[model samples]
Target: MPNPSDYIALGSQSEEETEPELEEDSEETEEEQQEEGFIPVMESPRVLAEKESKNGEATVCSNAGESGENSQGNEWNRGDIDGLFCPICMEAWTTTGDHHVCCLPCGHIFGFSCIRKWLQQQGTTKKCPQCNRKCTLKDVRKLFASRVVAIDGESQKRIQSLEAKCISLDKKNAALIKKEAEWKKKEAEWKKREALLQRELHQLKEKTIYLEHLLDVKPRTLGHPPSMGGYCVPSLGSEFNGQGPFILQKELGVDGARLFDIDASSKIILMTRRLQGLGGMHVLTKMSLVAPYTRQDISLPTGSKAVRDLHICPSDGSLSLFASLGKKLSVLSTKINNFILAYDLPAPAWSCSWDLNGSHQIYAGLQNGSLVVFDMRQTARPLEFVNGLTSNPVHTIYSLHNSTLPSGVTAVLSASSAGICQWNFGGSEERQPVVLETGNQGACISLAYCPSSDDIIASFRPRIDNSNEMAYSQHLLTPAIGQGVQGSHVHLKRFGSNCYQKLAVTCANVNDVRLPRSAVMNIESHGCLFASGDELTGELVLQELPSFTVIQHLKLRKQPIYDIKYVHDVDGGLLGCLCDDILQLYGNHALK
Candidate 1:
């Protein structure tokens, strides 16, 4: 609240006031004169002189009004002043403490406590009491009396001391605001640390479960002359004598081979390739299946190098091959008049496959940890390039043709030294792949898909140091030549999301010179029958898919085997074996 002397100066319209000037203004206001004949009046000069003459205990008094007002002969009282009451509390600023005047930036004054309470209740925004203009607490100024009645020296000292305390309280408030900011920063860091620990704990739990699974005893391996009694296993029938002429007249041998059945025409296609000497040759041979056990080779355009992988479309008899010399991919249709389309790859492609949904798309995994997909309609450029597991070379690939997954998501599984990884293709270019782990198995060597169960089967080579034992193995081979107890066992795994379950660990029928990479494994059309070639013993190891139980172990070829394939036709199952430059065909004798 402003001092009474300040209000007197405002009403007089001057910096200082005299008793006679205030008396003249009251007489000129004829309207106010008619109402009371006398308004509040300032103190006379004689009264001030008399008060100074007395002790400081002398009190200054005005006799014109008892209401809260200044002695200015002006409308300062509630009865005379207009808009002096607080709009929020509907009360006049009559009390000295609770109803102290607060002035806002808009030059409007109201009771301090009433406006403070109204602003706190609203919280977000506040308005001045008189003008209803937007305002805040910082925009308000608390008015304190600049002068008061003269008192004794001791009373005057007490008022000065109270003013000093208000300054100290303001400093304390600033320090508290800074302290609150520092504490909030620490809280955020602690929350981040807690989240990091939770992720680590989850990963540790997964590893513990995987280690326990590995500790389970290895499955018993079946050895010696395995029997074929209960299982529906196919074998070498009498039609094949294991004495077929070498493919390509033995002049040029095959580096890669694949068998494809043209389901539309009930005919099969046999594709092979061989490389020439210094000139960097590429010879792709397409054989036609005319009879049940006979095929005639038809030559196609040789590109740059030997084909590293060959695949033919089942829906359309389109032959695709990836060569090694220039890292080129070539596509040739069954029609002789069509031109051979070729696309250059950034790296050497080791495996290729066609899309399952007949989208005219082809995918090939390269040696540089990349999978390039090509749209057959546009053979001039690749459609997309995807990364694989780490930087390891991708050796095998299988297209997931299941309808269980969401649409627009094309998934492809590939195997490399780093492990098996699945790529989910969508819109983004920097898409990350999901890694498949199966305990502590060695590098992934092969990947196959089971259409019946929609499961993926993978083969891993057990980690062992053959570097120092090379000499001992060469010498022990003479006595253990026919002994089926080879230490090398192929580990089989079923792949899932970020994990794989061990299915079987069995010893393949092979000799010292043959490794697991040299043998070929394939799943039948129905996914129930699995077949693999044992190059060392020249035998076909037939097993049940996923379970990997040996159904039959039939000795077919006399020399090293190169590849093995299973075909479904009018006959139940026909087995094709590529060995020592020869291609032999066999089937169940029941079909004959």
Candidate 2:
């Protein structure tokens, strides 16, 4: 009949007054309640609505008859009535019912009837079922509400912090995945490079082993003279048949001498010289190899320019053949001191040579890489005019007449910057020139041939890499006699079966100026000998053939030798070294 709050206060006061009797009969009542399963008597809906309206917490519904539906809808929508159930009985509690929701001082809530029974079962030691707080039936204060809602501010803040941390962790994970993918790509590239390098290393090892086998077997089969690590080891005594080293017999100082050739039969040397104040006229200076060393200057025709190459007739020493930049190939009779034969050429001639097998045959190399063959029998025109492999000037030409080659094969060996080629002009069928492989040994600037040994010596200038403009310019401007210049290479090769086989190589101070000439001569007492100029010391270096053993270094006047000639006769041997300013003659002591 009274209000819900007044009824709750009156029930609490009566329960406190009857507490002693309830405790004395608590065990028996608890057993009976457990068997029957305690059921709380729920209050009517009108009373609950009245209590909720008085507390100012009830929602206003349009229809009072739908009050029950509105309360259920509110509980479902607010989602705060979940904690309004009794813990022990697991059922919703009523605000004014016998099993009302109540709380201990420690804030644990349970049904009032459930707490009373729970404490009565514990006898004198009554404590809260949820928090173990010491309490009795009087301490259970009822909650006067239809529904309960709690707001925990710290729990809300903790949830927001956890969501932010999840977002940060997701971004970090994405970055880590991207970095792993990039590392995988880099690792694949490195693995590919490693495989390629391994293949190259294996190929190099095979090549090295093959070369080592050749080195061990080749020297034995070729009957090459024994050498100590690519160096000739000479015996203790004199290297030149106990005559001691060659001594300087005579030195003729001549200005403007460019190239020269020796006439062993006549004991004379013919050199090309430019006479000063003669309007750049070039002449032949003749000198005797004997004691007084007399010199005679013979003038050429007005149109005869500076001779680029000079060679005496091998069969007849009285005649000399020379190529001049005046576009003329002329033959001079040393006896008459005049040119008796001259052939007009299409281009400037660079080098000339006479066929040793046929005295009537002559060959001229031109600046335009053309070989002009002439027969003395017909002076009107050349017998054959052929182009070389390249347009570079043919700086050297040598007639090859060896019996070991196929019969009726007359080949002319020529060398230019394009490399060495052998032209066959005396076969039944015309054949193209064969290019002999010299194994990438730069530009072939000069060549020396030994007919008896079937050996050829080629001098090379360091190859100019066109990609490096500065280096190419330096190569062009560098002087021929400088010490620090990248010197040159001299390779010794044997000619057989229409091919050339490289035998040995040596370094020299050869340069690309004036077409310096080197010589290979066969001496019965000294085997074969090779002579070349050493621009570094301005000396003529003499070495034993094939082995390249240094026999002597004849000191000159510290000038680059333009030409070297070795002449051997019944009397003795004579070596001639021609420089820009002087001509040096060295002979054995017997001849000296």
Candidate 3:
């Protein structure tokens, strides 16, 4: 008999080949044979012939009588046959010879049905059941059992079919991989272009925004004089031996006109007292630079008392009009289209001005010789009040606010019948205000301090003045007991200097020297110009500061001028005058 191991060497021989049997056989002991459980069986002649008829195909079956034996002397069971049982189900794979043996690319073996079921359970992973290695059905090979064999011709045919299928699959896989790579490259290019377009759009938006800002700030052309309440009235330029640039353009009739202001946009606000009535009126005149001089009159509701001071906020074009009738102070708000009144004051507000430091704060001088500061942000009450000065009425309030002052110091220069003093609004209540160069300049009538420079222009009269030297007196003056000027004189003083210089004494008979009340009166803006009205001659003199040379002078209609303001705008300086019931605009048309 032949040993099947000699014929079934792994991949060594064809399925139909067999090894020749030996002439002699070794005898085994009965007890050892029983322990080995070697079984042998004889086959029927009809089965053997039928198996050989199929082109020499063969099936090696285990002999039942020789089964249940272990060659290693261990107990033999049905699970001991190599490659004959399903590793997944732990069942005999050859029960009906329906299940085939399968091998994975990882070299692990399992029943074909078992591995197939496991791969389907794993979905796309297709892991082998025995070794858990990743492999799909394409990577799996159907392995044949050593006992089952096909003839040579049929085995060659199966190999050729598998090789053709593998080549076709490889071609399809190469095409898909190349297509995926191309799609990724195109997506990257598209994203890059999209980012570039976004940057361009952002730059365009920024440039558009910058152009809009330039349009807002750029000064437009003032093609013609503004449309006035009246036609153009030629200025009397050579009346007082004056040959300067300013010239009168329009002369309007505004009765009892006291306080007037012109904003940067040429908008004019005139505060005047009703000649025969109890209340006063505010005439808001909007003057457009680029005109046919545009003028639209908006008269606000009048108050019982005469409006003394008018202030227009530079930050916002809000109007603040102070009335001397009572403690009433009205704020004309164009934004809200109404007036805000603050009353119940201890004394009448004589003078008012906005903070020169470009804040929302306002300063007022009261008739009771007190100074009050108001924050327009919160109108409940004033932020600070300084009292206990001399009982003489506070006639002028000058906000000496500038960037050159020490930080945290908010001071104002106020003038009263007593003297000129500096009040620190940012200080405590107990701190006494410094009286800067105060003396016989009796009751400083008008005060102006330049925030950007050291120039301070103030006009005052002696306290012991004769009745003849009063503001409107036409009588001749007598030398009174006063260290300063007798009637009124303009003093230009530096910030840290003790001595004050008179304005060059350029003009004679100067009764009430005045400065422009507009907050825009810096040296650079208004060219250091101060104005004075001669009481006897009724001449309005415009003198430049430092070298107080006369710029221009206009003789009026024998009436005393109350105040004059320089219209601060791009078209040089325009002068506005209030004399009796007339409102005159000088240099309005010619400067442009």
Best by TM-score: 2
The local lDDT score (0 to 100) that residue 143 gets in candidate 1 is 54
lDDT per model vs. reference: 0.50, 0.67, 0.53
Give each model a TM-score.
0.48, 0.56, 0.49
Q: Tell me how many residue pairs clash in candidate 2.
A: 0
Per-residue lDDT over 145-246 for candidate 2, one digit per residue giving the tens place of the 0 to 100 score: 444545445566899999999999999999999999999999999998985675446334434543454455455436632221122225623453433346
* Residue pairs in candidate 2 whose N, alpha carbon or C atoms collide under 3 angstroms: none
Q: Candidate 2, overall lDDT? A: 0.67
lDDT of 1: 0.50
Clashes of 1: 1
- Rank order (by TM-score, best first): 2, 3, 1
As for lDDT, the candidate ahead, 1 or 2, is 2
Candidate 1, residues 280-321, lDDT tens digits: the string is 233444444452223333444444354555656645665544
Model 3's alpha-carbon lDDT is 0.53
Q: How many clashing pairs per prediction, in order?
A: 1, 0, 13
